[model samples]
Target: MQITASTVSLTVADVAASQAFLTAHLGYTVQAAADGFASLTRADAVDIVLLARGTQVLPPEQRDRHAAGLILAFTLADGLHDQEKRLREAGVEITMPLREEPWGERLFQITDPNGVIIQFVEWATSDDT
Candidate 1:
């Protein structure tokens, strides 16, 4: 299969709230939006689709489920600290403070209004392979 892009669709209690948070703090722009849905995009990151909870487009069994216990993570080539600082300056609360692991992974996390966890990560070494 040929994949041109990737997207994460999140079932949220408030689509507009998530949309606003992503657009204002995470550099995403609204590609499209309606009463209960929004498609957000950024040039260098995965597209995000926010769907209201209980959206009928999902299968009946899944329609009632909301995004939980999931962490949407972005791995950056560098500037992890700078990104964290920017987010902090924007009044985003850091759920996980910046820390480095023994495996050379530096990371932090934040929770959006809908309780979706987002993580930013960077490698201490160049060998991401």
Candidate 2:
């Protein structure tokens, strides 16, 4: 199959809040927007779609659902610490402080306004481990 692109759609109680958070902090730009929906994109990151909770476009069984227990993660090739510092300088709350794992993973997390966890990760080299 030939897949061109991918996007993650998040059903949030406040679509605007999530949209704003992504655009302001994560460097996402609005690709499109409507009363209850918004499409955001970043040049080198995953695209995001924000849908209001209970949006009519959703199937009846899923219309009331909200994005919970989901961690949208991005794996960066480098600069994890610099990115964390930039986020902190911008006043974005760091839900999970920077830490390194025994498995050579360095990461941190932040909670969006709607409580969706966003994680940034970088793998450590053998020397750094």
Candidate 3:
């Protein structure tokens, strides 16, 4: 089968908080929303669906589980530093500082109000590393 698009569904205590954080800080647009659910989209990133804990859309056993121990990462072609600076200027707390790995990967992270970890990454060429 072929896939047309991708989305990550996160269960949070407050759907609105995650929705607002993504839209205000990460450039996501609301595709749809309701009392306990929100669908967000961005042109250059994976779509996100936030569901409040206890939402019936989830299986009975999973409805109480919240998103944790997961890092939603987006890879960028360039401008990693600029993005970090922009977020900083916007008053977003950087949970992980920008750092380059020996393998030539540069990345940083921020935790949304709902405690979801979002990471932005860029790869350096051999010459630059």
Candidate 4:
């Protein structure tokens, strides 16, 4: 089977809060929204669906569960440092400062208002490693 698109649905305490964070900081556009739900999209990123905690649309067993211990990581084609600087300059807290791993991975992280961890990564070249 082939996947046409990708989306990540997150159950957040406050849908509006997480929606605002994704739109304002991550360049996501609101595709749709309702009292307790929001759909966000970006050309170069995965689509996002924000659902209010306890929303009935979710199965009973999953309704109360929140997005935790999950890191939504995006690998950038380039300019990882520049993106980090831009986010920092925009008053977005850098939860994890930019650092390079021994395995040639350069990455950083930030936590949204709903406590969703978003990570940006870039791979280093042999010369840079």
Candidate 5:
């Protein structure tokens, strides 16, 4: 009578590469791995899966074209500087310079090997609020 999303899959050039990124950079635990697929579980029961081209139950054309790269949104617990330091120490490439939004958020974006955008954000107090 009810349904909920348990997992989300995104196409990657290489499953191992994506797996390594999540493991090394984000500290997610790798739950499963196969020839061309890997699954990772983070806190709060969230699971992310990487399916390399030519694999997975998703459409063949979609895999072949690698059309379903995703936006992996991450919220920072500490301040913006802390997030910056962590990502910087990991040697992650910064696609857009960090910017403060008028709505009171400090956000930055970077893309992974599979062309998936990873947006990192932290709360920044608004000037008027």
Candidate 6:
């Protein structure tokens, strides 16, 4: 079987906050939205769908702790620092400032409302801001 597209949905307490964070920091475009549900997609087809917990998916406790551990990881084809600047300008708190991994990749991190850690990485130097 071939997996063409995939989306990981999160049961969120506040849809607006989640939407705003993703849109403002990561440049995700809203593909669908309502009072209880929302879907944000990136140009790379990465999707972040938000739904009200206990109504759309599981309870708050059942959410994958993976989000807290790794949260979400996004690869940046554009300049990593520039994106960091934008997120910072939007008042988004960055937990881990831009740092280079020993593996030779440039990466940074932030946390969402629920304390989910989000990661951004650049694997190549071709991306110049």
Quantify all predictions' global Cα lDDT against the true fold.
Answer: 0.93, 0.94, 0.95, 0.95, 0.76, 0.78
Model 1: lDDT equals: 0.93
What is the lDDT for 41 in model 6?
A: 91
Clashes of each: 0, 0, 0, 0, 0, 0
Score candidate 4 by TM-score against the native: 0.96
Error of 6 at 40 (Å): 1.4
Where is model 6 more than 4 Å wrong at Cα? 56-67, 124-129
The Cα error of candidate 1 at residue 109, in Å, is 0.3
lDDT of 5 by residue, 7-110 (tens): 77777778888788878877789888988888899876458888878775767668675635457777776576676667887899888778888778888887
Itemize residue pairs with steric clashes in candidate 2: none
TM-score of each: 0.94, 0.96, 0.97, 0.96, 0.81, 0.78
- What's the C-alpha lDDT at position 29 in model 1? 99
Error of 3 at 7 (Å): 0.6
lDDT of 2 by residue, 6-89 (tens): 999999999999999999999899999999999999989889999998988999998888899899999999999999999999
Clashes of 4: 0
lDDT of 4: 0.95
Which residue pairs show collisions in model 1? none
Q: Which pairs of residues collide in candidate 5?
A: none
lDDT of 6 by residue, 14-44 (tens): 7788888788767799999988688999868
Per-residue error at 79 for model 5, in Å? 3.0
| Tens-place lDDT digits, model 3, residues 1-129 | 999889999999999999999999999999999999999999888999999999887999999999999999999999999999999999999999999998888999999998999999999997784
Give the range where candidate 6 is weakest over 10 consecutive residues by summed lDDT: 62-71
